[model samples]
Target: MSSKSINISEEAYERLNSWKKSNDESFTDVIIRVLPQKRNLSEILECLEPIDEETAEEMKKAIDDEDSA
Candidate 1:
């Protein structure tokens, strides 16, 4: 695999080095492996708080129009 040189602060480098699984693994690999996955809006929307009163009224009107179609 291809590789490139990178500059980092001593503290940051130490952090990544501490997380490294083995000498064969690179800091880049460690970062990618630890990265969090993105979440979909629909998955969390059900838990969403209600919109403000004025916006809620406008939202109701829009939703009603959509439903009448």
Candidate 2:
């Protein structure tokens, strides 16, 4: 496969290097492993489990208390 060279700041290089599992891992591999996956709101919402009425009430109460404070 063909490759390209790009420049990064020293800080960026250090930060990326810190994520390497071992000297065997490449910068490209670290980036692909660490980057966040794109997900729509609906996709994210689908993963959430439903809360019980009691837990929901407690959360609402906590929010109300914080608002009052």
Candidate 3:
């Protein structure tokens, strides 16, 4: 496969280097591993478990107090 040259800032290079799983890992691999995957809102919502009523009320009260402040 042919590879193309791309330019990146020193800071960006350093950040990508830091994400390398090992010295043998390539920049392409690091990018693939670190990048976020696209997910639908329903998929994201499905991951969340429902909280109990008491805990829910406490959280609501905390928000109300923060809003009042």
Task: Go through the candidates in order and give each one's C-alpha lDDT.
Answer: 0.88, 0.95, 0.94
Among residues 3 or more apart in sequence or in different chains, the pairs in candidate 1 whose N, CA or C atoms overlap within 3 Å are none
Among these predictions, the greatest TM-score belongs to 2
Off by over 4 Å in 3: 1-5, 54-69
Residue 4's lDDT within candidate 1 is 83
Stretches off by above 4 angstroms in model 2 are: 1-4, 54-69
| Candidate 3 residue pairs that clash | none
lDDT (Cα, tens digit) per residue for candidate 3, span 24-66: 9999988878897899999999999999999999999999999
lDDT digits (tens) for residues 1-69 of candidate 1: 788888999998898899999999977889889875576888678769878999999999999999999
Q: Across residues 1-69, which tens digit of lDDT does each residue of candidate 2 receive?
A: 687899999999999999999999998889889997899999999999999999999999999999999
Model 1 worst lDDT window (10 residues): 35-44
lDDT of 3 at 26: 100
lDDT of 3 at 41: 98
